[model samples]
Target: MKPGTFLKSTALLDGTFFERSVIFIVEYNDKGAMGFVINNPFPRKLNELEEFKHIIPFPLYLGGPVDQEHLYFVHRRPDLIEGGTPVDAGILLGGDFKAAVKHIDEHTLTGNDIRIFIGYCGWDDGELDAEIAEGSWEVLEGGMLL
Candidate 1:
């Protein structure tokens, strides 16, 4: 698997953290692998959080089972958001948060342009490969996935 690849959890992971989850890979290499669960939406919005209460209310998603206190984001607006690392094609991971907030408040950035997440999923070394080989996930390819 590579960056921008989507991994759909199989029935093998039923009743687990990855049950029926769809993950968007942001980094994949010899060192490790990391991704966000694109299909799981968190019930709370940004405005409900103490730190982000000043920011506009925006939908938040449950990225995975790690780093729940921090925020992560994926966007297609590198031109508008700036400093984003490309996952593939036009998709980007992280960027200038100040600029993102500015654009967001100014109505330049919308939900269609970015997806914010709390936490992320990660696998060390060959852990992901082993899981895939065991049929825990089905890799989906082709086209840009937001």
Candidate 2:
């Protein structure tokens, strides 16, 4: 799969934490695949975090089960925040955090234009393909889900 793909957990993944998870694939290559769960919220507001205290409140999502301490983001406002990595049409993976915060604080960026996530899902070389072969995930285009 390439970047901008979407992975939906199948029944084969039932009884696990990833069951029913919908992931937005941000990176995929010969080496590995990386993405985040877009539907699971972490029950915390964005403004509650020290780094985002100056910005408006927004929900924080549990991107996946890996690297839980780190933060990540996706957005459709590259015009407002420069240097973002494109994920799909009108969607960006990340950009300058300070600039984004500043823009948000200035009311130039609204919550509808951004999504904050913590952690991410990943698979080693060929691992994702193996999982897909085993019916663990259903791959589709990014637009189909998000």
Who wins the TM-score comparison?
A: 1
True-structure RMSD, every candidate: 1.2, 1.8
Give the alpha carbon lDDT tens digit for every residue of 43-114 in model 2. Answer: 988789887787777777999889999888888887787888887777888898777778777878776788
Query: Candidate 1 regions off by >4 Å?
Result: none
Q: Which tens-of-lDDT digit does each residue in 1-146 have in candidate 1?
A: 78999999999999999999999999999999999998888999977888668878888899999999899999999888879998987899999987887887678999889999999999999999999999999988774556
**What's the CA error at residue 41 for candidate 2, in Å?**
1.3
Q: How close is every model to the real structure, measured as TM-score? A: 0.95, 0.90
lDDT of each: 0.89, 0.84
Model 1 residue-pair collision total: 0
